[model samples]
Target: VGRYLVQLPRGALSAHDDALRRAGIRVRRGGAVLGAGGKASLGPLSPARRKPPSSSPRLDAITLQEQLERALRERQARPTGICPVREALHGALLEELAGTIARDEPRRGTLLRRVAGEARMTIDAYRTVYEKSLLFGASKLSEAAALKGNLEGRIAELQAETASLADEVRSLTDLCESLEHRAQRAEAQAEAETHDASALRAEGEQLQGLLDALRPG
Candidate 1:
């Protein structure tokens, strides 16, 4: 009903206001609708006033019930359409229903109170469970996020260390290659020196034989 009023065009709402006024309901600011005798109209869009249940009214249940039936019959007789008159009739019907309930509730008040108390307790229990679950889930999510960050940091450190080790390995490999080339050259020079020494020794022996052959002995 509040949404209906809010969405209504200004012109249409004005018309509704007039109809509601004729029906003894005043449309107040903030979507409050006060019916005759200062009773607040009950609706999803209306804020309900908190009041203790009253003692049953002096009115006879049968008489009030007849009036309620008559009002319902009158409302059903009207043509259905989106109009101020229809809205007025609907509000009047609701007032009749509320009046009937208020007048009749005393007879069943005890049972109603007990049921209401049980319902409140049930709602509170569910709310507590839901809040605990939500907190637990949030805590677990925070922990998981922290763990993921730590693992990522560790992985980054390992990758940097691996790169450094690879650089050292390359340096050692280059040094080893240079030393191998030097060793090969040394081996070649040693072989040439050996050949030269062998040739000189042979020549010395041959010259000694030539001198002996040339000497008269």
Candidate 2:
């Protein structure tokens, strides 16, 4: 017998024949059964003379075939969209296809491009923040420059005022020195007048004493 069983015809006799062939019994052209080694005739395995369990094949291919056929009929009778079997099989196949596509370089590159687009959006957001920060810094710097200019102007005014004060102080110092010299000369004149008064008083006293001596006899 061949490794693969030949397709059996659709009948009880055909099933019996296939089963016999599976069990290492071969039927010849004239309905005689021979052993697998061509030894001798076992008997004929016709459907009419076949007994129940004694002549039965180890596995009944007819019953299994009937079950498969019934299952196919039921599946065909079901609505296409609501059938669980079809959906499950389709889902499994889709999962396998997805896995295959995921491994392909072009599909992977498309996913990478999507991620890169998101990254670019994030970078743009940061750039906006950076630009606002730069504007704020520039504003602060401008204010500082304006304040410095104001301070410089105030300092110039103060320096000019200080120069005027210094000139006034110098004039006052010159006036004070002139007044001190005048006060010293006035003190010397007062001392010389006091000495002259004392000398006049002494001479008058000596003349008075001589007159009094001559008038007395």
Point to the candidate with the largest lDDT: 1
Model 2, global lDDT: 0.61
Q: Which runs in model 2 stand beyond 4 Å of their true positions? A: 1-122, 203-217
TM-score of each: 0.43, 0.41
Give the per-residue lDDT digits (tens) of candidate 1, residues 85-123: 454554554444454454558545555555556765786
Cα lDDT tens digits, model 2, 1-217, are 2122333443535446556766865554333444565444634244322222323333544654565456547667454424556444444434433433455565775665566567657866876887899999999999999999999999999999999999999999999988988888888888888888887787788788888888968
Q: Which portions of model 1 miss their true places by more than 4 Å?
A: 1-127
RMSD of each: 15.7, 26.7
What is each predicted model's overall lDDT from 0 to 1?
0.64, 0.61
- Clash pairs detected, candidate 2: none
What is candidate 2's CA lDDT for residue 46? 49
Top candidate, metric TM-score: 1
